[model samples]
Target chain A: MNRLGLGGWAILVLAAIFFITPLVMTATFSFWEGGDRYGFDSYRILLHSPKLFESAWLSIQLSLASVLALLVLLVPAMIFMNLYAPRLRPVFEFMATLPFVVPAIALVAGLSALFTGPEWLIGTPFYLVVPYFFLGLPYAYRAIDVGLKSIDLDTLTEAGQSLGASLGQIIRLVVLPSLRSAMLGSALLTLAVVFGEFTFANVLLFHTYAVYINEIGQHDPTEAAALSVASFLLTWAAMLGVLVLGGGRRPAVGGR
Target chain B: MRSPLAVFFIVLFLAVNVLFMLAPTAMLAIQAVFDDDGAFTLEYFQALAQYQYASSFENSLILSLLSATVGVIAGGLIAFAVLKDDAPRWLRSVVTSFSAVAANFAGVPLAFSFIATLGTLGLLTKLLKTWGIDIYAAGFSLYSIGGLTLVYSYFQIPLMVIIFFPALEALRPSWREAAENLGASTWQYWRLVGLPVLAPSLLAAWILLFGSAFSAYGTAYALTSGNIALVTTEISAVLSGNVVSEPQIGAALSVGMIVVMVLVLLASNLLSARAARWSVKS
Candidate 1:
């Protein structure tokens, strides 16, 4: 540890505090007792709050739907871009980065305006999923693009085609396996974005886990903090899950 | 190139992009310029002279600049610390994964974590007070521009690591060795070779961070509870029918933000084009 140098150790400590402090404080605070100060009280509180379950389950479901939509929409386009539409790849790339350029608040504003006529859509979970899909596009595209880029995707396609393999088999047996790491990375990233999202969910008035936590924070901070810890852990698990389990060797498609 | 299924998916993707991405943007721009009367007017843009709106713009600009600057430096240091060969490989992987998660980990819960960490009655604040310094009484409040910068920098630093990592990882140690072989000192090599190689991307990265911080809404909103008047909050205020109930003006603020982002991005694009040329040379 001493051999790691002052600069190295300093950075390690900085990261530890920055990453862990809130988590520790929140975990400890969540179990707070106004009467005695620590137990399973917060979890018990969380258990009784059906709104918590409704919102959390809704978030997970919506996140799954969004991921399904993203992979379905993105993977093929990613494959097609490199394989056939190389000229249009730049245009598509520009479009993918659009979400980053546009502020999330602005997106909420514009989207709300878009749905001002059909106000009913505002209340639906899947409507949130649509914008959520758009929200995840930039990261998902970058990750999958890295995954697609990691191997000689174009050459693999050509080889598969010439060998009389069907396109379905090419995507399934040829592409998906090689793009495994990218797919996993993209999936986790998309899930994390959807799960942690607040602006769109709040503005759209949908009760995703983040929105629920924010609402709960306003009233019961201890419980809110517990939920925050849980929220962070869920995303962290997804994150570390990808890092540790997604790849057999080093992650070829590192975070973008 | 033109398989039927591929073509269908491409059409679907384009349709969704147009409907969700392009169309909403066009709608927002229109609302910013037009009024409830459905006629063209610059009243909203002209009203930027108002204190509430203008301050938000100014605050956002300063906040993003400060955060991005510090974030890049911190991120660079951590990237080096973790990515080194002798350092624990687990820590490196954890850092990389954490950045990916942390970069997306913002909004409400993030704001709560910050409050617990550094709010006026925050744990760290109280902890430091015992050591002879009262952070809040020293005029450091978590509900101000400084606080927003602190929160923004947390996410911004990790983003810098994520964006900067691939490039940094690709830089072979042999380059430094080769430079040393030519009698170049560490500082000399970095100054002459290393900095030049990385200069453009660094600039590009700073701009990206700038945009990220600039557009950020949730953290600032949750932390300040509408106390800080960054553009995003101002837009939210107007949208929620709080200070000024004019949705058009909110749209105008949104437009103002979009304009700033466009300019920043255009500059980033220019820097990246130059960056491509720089990389090609080596």
Candidate 2:
């Protein structure tokens, strides 16, 4: 029964118009198979495109790899930071935010400049997991940091130690289970990044789902619009996943 | 607290991050300042003065500034409205969740959505034309920087709401009562108490939005197909140009971007410190 005031209602209405028009229009435009015709033609075309399947598969693989790499590198490091080297919190934080400075465009350019690696490292699409991991670092680290801060780590570790648990067991059994929401949040973020990523995949000559959509867009606007709707829904789902799973914490999103 | 295992993991973490994160940045700086002979040079930096590169930087600055300003004002208001005492819980939950999704709703899909809404023969374009308002004839092409500003603000506005809402919420209700008790009117209380406390967070959020817009590539690339001279697209052009692939010049532009980002980062850090102090006081 609370009121948002006249100004609030107006602002909200304007925001809704601004935000929803494009999405609604995109969906409408996708269904229009040109001039009084409307059917599932665009969706059919997109669904039948092998390129769509291939690239989507690749993006999913890359997302999994990136999330795995990110979790492996960050979870233990965060635990270590919280327990032992709290003084280095600022340094780690600074490092995490470093990716914000080097956006994907700049990172890819710098990456190409520094691309003297062995072919095995830079040749395959799997190498992209490296930069993807870097891209996810800032948001992922913050999510994990928030999780770590919320839990009583010292007490948990001491209790585990008194119960004759190994450090590995303590981390696996005592810490990570409590940090599930944080891990899920970071994983969802990495998923969003990998799925929506285009600059690196395009420049690096890998055809990700995004790059495929861009290609399809050039030849078929309607089909591309259809794919765009799907992509938007995917992003919404991932973000919603964070909200639902993170227990209403503000998910670290945006930038790049 | 200082276990050997923890030390080992910390060192490993540092090594992995430094090698992946810092090395590329260092390599970029080196490439920007050095030549094929491996000697120091400034030719690439000088190349940034050329019309294409200079204009891209100018265009980017203008676009980012425009979007960030609009985003902050509108988004700040939206946050304020959502956080008002009379606002309902459902409104807060919906706005928070939508902001989370909308903030991440950028890149190619965003570009496609905008195009479908505003491009020639687009749904809205056709709809408006029937009402006697030809936007394209009004020179409102979705391919221009102005068009990009409108699109960029979609994500930027939501991002502002997400980042600034917490700071706004941190304002204690008692503070307003304290100001009102001193005979200050609502406007006076906000001018003296609310605005001062919110300034740092607002500035920091603005800078963050600017950085986000400035470095964005996929949206502009997909929207204009690199027709617009954004620094990001320009870097892509320089690297992918078959006739004249100047990786050095690309490095120069990337370095310029890094410089601007570093400045934004430093300003953000300082502002965050100020905001933190304000939050602590409140």
Predicted structure with the largest TM-score when compared to the true one: 2
How much lDDT does each candidate structure score? 0.80, 0.87
- Per-residue lDDT tens digits for candidate 1, residues B78-145, read 88677766788788777887897787677788888888778776667877988999988889988888
Q: Which candidate gets the maximum DockQ versus the true structure?
A: 2
- A155-210 per-residue lDDT for model 2 (tens digits): 87888899999888988887887778889888988898788898889888899999
RMSD to true structure for each model, in Å: 3.3, 3.6
Best by lDDT: 2
CA deviation > 4 Å runs, candidate 1: A1-4, A150-155, A245-256, B84-86, B130-132, B278-282
Candidate 2, residue A176: the lDDT equals 83
Residue A177 of model 2 has an lDDT of: 79
- Which residue pairs in candidate 2 have backbone atoms (N, alpha carbon, C) closer than 3 angstroms, thus clashing? none
Report clash pairs, candidate 1.
none
For B165-282, candidate 2 gives per-residue lDDT tens digits of: 8888888888888887888888888899989999998999999999999999989989877677988988888877732747899999999999999999999999889988867643
